[model samples]
Target: MSRSVSSHTSPVVRVDDLRVVFPTMDGDVHAVNGLSFEVPAGGALGIVGESGSGKSVTSLALMGLHRGSRARISGAIEVAGQNV
Candidate 1:
């Protein structure tokens, strides 16, 4: 969505400063950092990345599937003005 879009018709999906980290005994693996984007109602959003590039991790975060995982996720994900 464009930045000029007014607040009255806000985005249907929003992600801000999304970061996913896995703390292994070896070290911390940063999957994503400072990712932000928005998709307006009826709009489409695409995510593309190479293998092991955090695409699946990001999706897992969006779907609330990492609740019990050892990974640490920080940031905001909103759908229809509500946090996910």
Candidate 2:
């Protein structure tokens, strides 16, 4: 069953001013830059961009799959009102 989103309920996922930079021998590669959005309860998300436009990188950042790597992550990422 589908339910309407509650105005009073907090977002299920929130990403604010997120940035992901991968340091390389040559130079730094910006995977995701200044990306911010929120998906409320019972809400949905869609990311559309060209190839190499940080789509996959953003998803990885949300899941914290970039950890243990040389990637530098900043800003605030929250899921269910808890930091990710």
Candidate 3:
């Protein structure tokens, strides 16, 4: 589960300042804010949070599977060393 930072060929995924916002009847829900992390090639990473913590949304974002097109996402998201 551990990997040498310099040994990995490239980051399997890279998220920087990643944010996701949703507009609702009340206003806006900040699902994610300034989230940042990297999973290097052949490496393991874990995300832990309470319900509605944006955990699934963040992973889906990495897979390019966010539900709404209206969702506002800022910052950078890279997968397999490529921007998405």
Candidate 4:
């Protein structure tokens, strides 16, 4: 996919290299692996993925909804033009 500059100002949410990892009994399971996307204000976005594709996890991360302290996250997550 091509990353194009939005015609407007900064997007409402800008996710770059967003990674979400969960710790399992076996080892650390990588949910979101270096996934990057941008959602401009008033723009609609859809994420298509099978089970365990990190679709829900990515949204949870963006909405600050994650369980346990064992979840390890890296990279950048910006919401409302502010990095979280």
Give the per-residue lDDT digits (tens) of candidate 3, residues 2-43: 545665377788899999988788998889999998888767
Candidate ranking (TM-score, best to worst)? 2, 1, 4, 3
Which stretches in model 1 have alpha-carbon errors above 4 Å?
A: 1-8
Candidate 1, RMSD to the unseen true structure = 3.7
| Model 1 weakest lDDT span, ten residues long | 1-10
Whole-model lDDT values for every prediction: 0.91, 0.94, 0.84, 0.84
Cα-based TM-score, every candidate? 0.88, 0.92, 0.82, 0.83
Measured on C-alpha atoms, candidate 2 has an lDDT of 0.94
lDDT of 2 by residue, 1-84 (tens): 868888888999999999999999999998888999999988999999999999999999999999999999999999999999
> After superposing candidate 4, which stretches have Cα over 4 Å from the reference?
1-6
Off by over 4 Å in 2: 1-3
TM-score of 1: 0.88
Highest-scoring model, lDDT:
2
Give the clash count for model 1: 0
* True-structure RMSD, every candidate: 3.7, 1.5, 2.6, 4.7
